[model samples]
Target: MNQLGHLKQFRSSVPRKRSMGRRKIEMKTIDKEPARLVTFAKRRVGLFNKANELSTLCGAEVVILLFSESGKVYSFGHPNVNSILDKFLVQNFLPEENVPKIMEESVQGTKNSQVVKHEIMTELLSKVGVEKKRGKALDQQREEETLLGGEWWQGPIEDLDLPKLNHLMLSIHGFIELAMAKANMLTLGTKNGCK
Candidate 1:
């Protein structure tokens, strides 16, 4: 059996060896984000490729989620990625207290998105002096379009089927309105509580 093939298979796994032995390699802690980011990028690509190959060769499913030292996430998998992760999460039941607070804030902020959207639209409409009837109609059009799913600005407006086109427009308008409204309420609540 050729052991060389295995070595070649995981070339990145070979740690850099010290040219001189006996004395431990004096290493300094990494303090720079750019340097850490570059190292992370190189290693992440290598890890992802290895995972892909392992899955292909062994006829086994594989999924890997990596958190870089600086706190960025990278993941790779064969078959369904989220399922594997969900299972692990359920099994572990571990709290990620070490994860940066900003990531948590971003995730939490995205919750209750529709209300946030509506508030923003309401504010914009008010500023622009748009009539409530027109706003409601626009919101309705955007709502329907969102249910269908697609970017509205890309295609020819006239070419779309009347029903589908109308749906898309309504969805966009509705999404904005919902998000804006939710945001306004959230902001107001936060302010009131703070006071």
Candidate 2:
């Protein structure tokens, strides 16, 4: 029955504000000349920006050509359109059926190798995620190494909590198994003849 109660009541009574952000634009032609021109400029800028991002982030070569209502040409390319066009032309000069390609590695053998893989782009993005996880694991390992002054072998079995003890047991089992395997391999030769 005080100012706090009044303030809470007042706050509850007030309506929520609407979001002032981008919304869906109508997919119809603008009849007005000025409006159309403005829209074209804005859309062109957005298109070019996206192309630049695609080129930069994915290490892709891209070329975009746009024409205005008045026949003015607008173009955007990462490493110049002419070079890309030339490469394309050289690769495609002979018809696909006619040309017998020699199975030689590319001079820039990076992107060419991945072209035949299933969902290569998705794989590449997944690799980024894996690298990020690996980087975090590496950082954590470095911190632990700094704290322990070497590989983290937890000491004083009694000091370890239940989960830590369980983890330690698992690690010990793995080490024993690995040692046993190496001992067996040393005593007995492998199927492929161990190097």
Candidate 3:
């Protein structure tokens, strides 16, 4: 019996470790009734604990409503469920005295929305005007080059005056780039189902 033989014997004699810990479960609707019921109970307790903690820490009113598998209603609320429900109903439903105040708020909201719509329309119109101006400039430049008896880009760059050549190059490049960007944006918008 050498050291290698003793090591081999010890390895063979040792028991394999078994995993006894809880595993991470995938979230989905449970099909088995008994398992679903057990999970529901456990989750309900955890939910109540979280709600209680939130209410205590924030000094805030909290309410939760749930239905069990058997269709029984379960509710959790701080400072009672009925009081919270009554408060919600009163605030949302409104008494006759509060009707005028609600109407005033609604009117103000409408006016604010109208102002926003007007501003957006104005901005869109300004962009359209800029595009129209650019289109006109490009058309004028093309006509001028035609009248000069050939495409400006086709003519020898060294033959033209430096200032005129610089102006032509800048105008053509700027217009073409802007137009291409606008075309690309329009194409993307249509592809994405945008108006």
For each candidate, what TM-score against the reference? 0.30, 0.38, 0.39
Ranking by lDDT: 3, 2, 1
Candidate 3 residue runs with Cα over 4 Å from true position: 1-22, 94-195
By TM-score rank, best first, the candidates go: 3, 2, 1
Per residue, candidate 2 scores C-alpha lDDT tens digits across 1-195 of: 899999999999999898878988889999999999999999999999998887776666778879899999898988875455334433433245422221122233445533522243466578769967866866786687678675444466667678656656766786796797687656433332433
lDDT, residue 126, model 2: 89
Model 1 C-alpha lDDT versus the unseen true structure = 0.62
**Among these predicted structures, which one has the highest lDDT?**
3
CA error at residue 6 for candidate 2, angstroms: 25
lDDT of 3 by residue, 1-195 (tens): 999999999999999798889988898999999999999999998999898887676665667889997999889988655455444433444466745544454446665543543454587689779978977987897798789786756668787788668778777888897797788667644653544
Cα TM-score of candidate 2:
0.38
Instruction: Give residue 176's error in model 3 in angstroms.
Output: 44
Q: Which ten residues in a row have the lowest lDDT in candidate 1?
A: 85-94
lDDT of 1 by residue, 20-134 (tens): 7567634765579888677678868998898788667665567887977667767787875644433343323224652343234334555443353345447656855765776
lDDT of 1 at 84: 48
All candidates: CA RMSD in angstroms? 22.0, 23.2, 20.1
* Local distance difference test scores for all models: 0.62, 0.65, 0.71
- Model 3 per-residue lDDT at 19: 86
Whole-model lDDT, model 3:
0.71
